[model samples]
Target: MVRGKTQMRRIENETSRQVTFSKRRSGLLKKAFELSVLCDAEVGVVVFSSRGKLSEFSSSSMQRSIERYKSYAKEKNLKHRGAEDNIQLQLCKQEAASVAKEIQLLETSKRKLLGESLETCSTDELQGLEVQLERSLTNIRLWKKHMLTEQIAQLKAREKMLLEENAALDRQWKEECLQHSAVSEEAAHDDRTSQHTEVETDLHIGLLGRGRTQCLLQA
Candidate 1:
């Protein structure tokens, strides 16, 4: 009678287990060859013993058979890689969105600091912003003070120049006044001498007329 089908359990005896492995490995290879021959197709088989020994069979040179297997494997990998690339693209988009969100937050913060009040900010936040504005105002005040100091220096320089110009004008005016006084004194002296000479001539003529009258009466 045909032995009943062996139970599906591990063979406890090492020799039996090894023998079974060999038999199964050979049967699988034989089946592979049969399939190739019947279908007029290429075939390859590879097995490893429990002791880590390798066994292989192929329709062609082992290298060529491996290369062919790799080519077919690459085709499968390409299909999987397309899916993987889509997943990676989705991940990249998510990361970019996250980065964009972070950038928007930073921009909002900067805008808040620059005195732009948005609906997102609270009154307390606005107060903090006001403090920062006050600090900025203080700095501006200091800068204005510096500018005013420079302007004051410039004004002082202009004032000194004006003073010098005024002093020079005063000197010129004093010199002109002295010249006019001297001219007036000389004119007055000439007028007095002319009047004295006219008076003396008149007195001499009158005396001469009285003497002529006396001499005619005596004649």
Candidate 2:
């Protein structure tokens, strides 16, 4: 029988500590053996003393018992993990289904927003939207027409200005040519008159000198 309450702390005395360990080790091995025999369970236990000595217990051959225990524990862990994975897979499927439903609802809402829910639309609403679209198209066409008309008017105005400028330049050029021709003619006439005047003055001087020489000979 256990005598007293086991202290929670480690025993400070080496002798007490060794005694406690020996007692616990014996008890654990005995319980393990009884459990295997009565419950048809497999068991394996191993211990290392402070001095590096090995002790072990098993219900069957130690290798067989240890292998069996490992196999049982592995199967239990695998089964538990598989169950958890199945639950997670189910949750994922449910979430995916819910997300798909949400996406469908959003798609429907978007269609409605885009005015594709014709069955739910009233006649007035449909007519109003149609009228608004027609008015918008009319406004756009009118803007295009106005732009085209303005562009044509601007081109016509530019053409008219160019024509007027061309006419003015032609007229100015003709006037300049006429003025230049008239000035050239006047310069030619002035040159001929100056030449004739010089010839007449020379002839007069020659004839006067001859007449004076003849008068001196007669005297």
Candidate 3:
């Protein structure tokens, strides 16, 4: 019969757990010894029990091996951190490029909606087109209203100017009429004085003629 594979979680029963720990520890130490002997390598292993008991295997001086391991770990961490930083920089660049492309696409869509382009627009874009058109129409109405109000204000100003001009002209006409009336009255008075003087002179001449005729008849 074939044995099934064992799962790697902790054994729950206290006796079973202790038995498993002993067997695994011995196997691990044997493997470390064999690796050092066969390959002429520096080998080190450390294990800790649940109760904090320490176990270790080393092919050479344990203290020297631990110091070497610490230096190797520090150098490896530095190299790996540099590589991770480079990777993060590349990711940031790619993300920026993607965001720029998205902004460009949005700008193109806006231009299309503003009547700057009709080509390449699809039925899929129609939903956004309606919203754009509504906003455009509202702006157009406001602009038209502003222009109309300006025109009305200009007309009102022109009306006021014309009324002022007409009033000025009327006042000038009335002044001229008064001056002409005075000139006419002065001319009429001069004509009446000249006519009265001429009539009196003619009557004086007629009386002299009658006096001369009566003196001749008496003689």
Which candidate gets the maximum lDDT versus the true structure? 3
> Which lDDT values do the candidates have, in the order given?
0.91, 0.91, 0.94
Better candidate number, 1 or 3, judged by TM-score: 3
Q: Give candidate 1's TM-score.
A: 0.43
Candidate 3 residue-wise lDDT, 88-154, digit = tens:
9999999999999999999987788767776777776776788878988999999999999999999
Model 2 lDDT per residue over 91-170, tens place: 99999999999999888756755678769778886787678778978999999999999999999999999999999999
Clash count in backbone of candidate 2: 0
Candidate 2 TM-score, true structure as reference? 0.50
lDDT of each residue in 1-219, candidate 1, tens digit only? 898899999899999999999899899988988888899778888888878999888866678888988999999999899999999999999999999999998988898887675677888988888898899899999999999999999999999999999999999999999999999999999999999999999999999999999999999
Regions of model 1 farther than 4 Å from truth: 1-110, 117-135
Regions of candidate 3 where Cα sits further than 4 Å from its true position: 1-111, 114-124
lDDT at residue 50 of model 1 (Cα atoms): 73
What lDDT is reached at residue 160 by model 2?
100
RMSD of 2: 13.0
lDDT (Cα) of model 1: 0.91
The full ranking of all candidates by TM-score, starting with the best, is 2, 3, 1
Candidate 3 structure lDDT? 0.94
Whichever of 1 and 3 has more lDDT, that candidate is 3
TM-score of each: 0.43, 0.50, 0.46
How many Å off is the CA of 122 in candidate 1?
A: 11
Candidate 3 pairs with clashing backbones: none
